[model samples]
Target: MFRTENALILREVRFKESDRILTALTADAGKMTLAAHGALSKHSRIAAATQQLTYAELTLFEKNGRYTVREGVTKEGFPGLRQDLGKLALGSYFAECLEQYAGEDQPEPELMQLGLNSLYALSEGLGSCEKIKAAFELRLMTLEGYAPAEESCPVCGRGDIREPVFLPEEGQTVCRACRKAGRSLPLTENALAAMRHILHAPAKKLLAFRLTEEEQSLLSAVAESWLLHCSDRNFPTLAYYRNLKL
Candidate 1:
């Protein structure tokens, strides 16, 4: 059967000399591995759409349980990200995280939208790279049911947590007065506020908040630590992105 879907090309590998194997996150079907015949050829019509980090509308043929690309049209190539190595590395890291967390054969429209929005924001320079990275990390972890409780200090029941420290393992915050001896990342007021915004903001306004350089650094650390704790694994792409920053 033939069907068309909007998908983000998360990763691609060469399959033989001219064909390609694509790992795509579809709007309706979650993640899928697709065979794209001749997609790697210099003259292939679908080459642009099948490249990693490109969002495309693809015509796919499915037989039994496998899929093959029949046609593809690139919708957003994110040219701005391509022009900057740092942005591109960060975008690639996002793609890798999506591949790891997104479920196959499940409808994940929210996740799909988050991926598209993040890429669009990065491509358009709507926010700083660090801001975007922190937002995406926290939001994606929330979507996957690992959201940290930032509403208040879990220990004191204080709605306003002054001088908060984030506990990655506990997935919540505690006021400095209530913090116990454990692994924790201290959060500046702005960093804590940014985390709340990222966790609760609407998709369109997820990246609307701003932060000072120090605050951004703190937020990024909290976000990454939370994600790494919840996911329980490291991503090579993430390491590469960090290396690029350094």
Candidate 2:
């Protein structure tokens, strides 16, 4: 059987000296690994189609639970991404999320749209990279059914959050009244509200979003804390982006 779809080459590796193994995040299929014959050769047609960060229509030859990518052509170059390190880092971060969280052959239409929209925003150097990144993380949390309780503290149902701290392992938010004395996550109300807004807003408007510098710093802290608590791994790309001067 043969399948075709708009896909991004998420990862690639050399195989057998002449062939390559490509892992793609597809619009329809969440993720798939395909064989690309001679992708490294001098006159390889598959090379262009399978370039990392290149969005393209991919044709795959499939049988016995595996796929070999046969042909492809570009749909969008996202040229702006290559021009800025910050944008590239953001792109890489999102791609990492796709690889780590999204399951294979389990279509996530919402995530696909999120990826497309985010890529566009990154390509254009949209003014709110921090906002966009925060929104994306919050949306991803929502998709996983772990969205923070924005209307009120997840534990005490308090309308006012004085010092809200999110406990990712427990997947809930705690308010000042309910906060344990030694809990290290002392997040500000500004951060919590900003995260809540991003989680609740429509995806199309995520990139156009803005946050005050104070709110931005707080939001970043909360987001970094949440993601670290959830994934329990250091995200080097994110660290690099944070250090980057605007």
Candidate 3:
């Protein structure tokens, strides 16, 4: 059967000499692994659309539960990312996260939107890289049903946590008075406010808020730690991105 879908190419591996295998996140099919014949050849038509992080409309043929790309047209190649190594690394990290967490053969429109928005933000330089990273991490976790309770301290039921410290394992914030001995990252008031905004804001307004350098650092640390804890795996792309930043 032949069908069409809009998909983001998350990862690609060389198959044989000229063919390619792609891990794609589709708007309707969630995640799919697709085979693209001759994608590596110099004269291949679909090569550009099949590149990692390219968002494209793909014509696919499915048989025996396997998919092959018959045609592909790029929707948004995010050209700006390639010119800047930092943005490219961060964009690659986003792709890795989506490939890891998005469910296969399930519709995940919201997650798809988040991934697109994140890449667009990076490609367009819409916000500070740190801010974008923090927002994406927190929002992705929320979409996966692991949203942290930023509204109140879980232990004391206090809506106003003046001295907030985030517990990654528990996926919640607590007042310093209620903090225990496990891993906890302290949050400044600005960092806490940013976290709340990230969790509740709409897609377009996700990075609307501002933060000082110190506050951004705090938020970045919290967001990364929380996501790693919830996902229970470390991403090599994330490590590479961090190394690039350093």
lDDT (Cα) of model 1? 0.92
Q: What is the C-alpha local distance difference test score of each model?
A: 0.92, 0.74, 0.93
Better of 1 and 2 by lDDT: 1
Evaluation by lDDT, superior candidate among 2 and 3: 3
Q: Which candidate is the best by TM-score?
A: 1
Clash tally, candidates in order:
0, 0, 0
How high a TM-score does candidate 2 get? 0.85
Superposition error at 199 for model 2 (Å):
1.4
RMSD of each: 0.9, 2.7, 1.0
**Candidate 2's residue-wise lDDT over 68-109, tens digit each?**
888988887788988988888888787777666777878867
Q: What is the TM-score of each candidate against the true structure?
A: 0.98, 0.85, 0.97
Candidate 1 vs candidate 2: the TM-score winner is 1
The deviation in Å at residue 92 for candidate 2 is 1.1
lDDT string for model 1 (1-246, tens) is 999989999999998999989999987999999999999888899999999999999999999989999899999999999999999999999999999999999998989999999999999999899889899999999999989999988888998898999998899898988998889898987788889999999999998788889989889999999988988999998999889989
Report how far off residue 185 is in candidate 1 (Å). Answer: 0.7
The superposed Cα distance between candidate 3 and the true structure at residue 210, in angstroms, equals 0.8
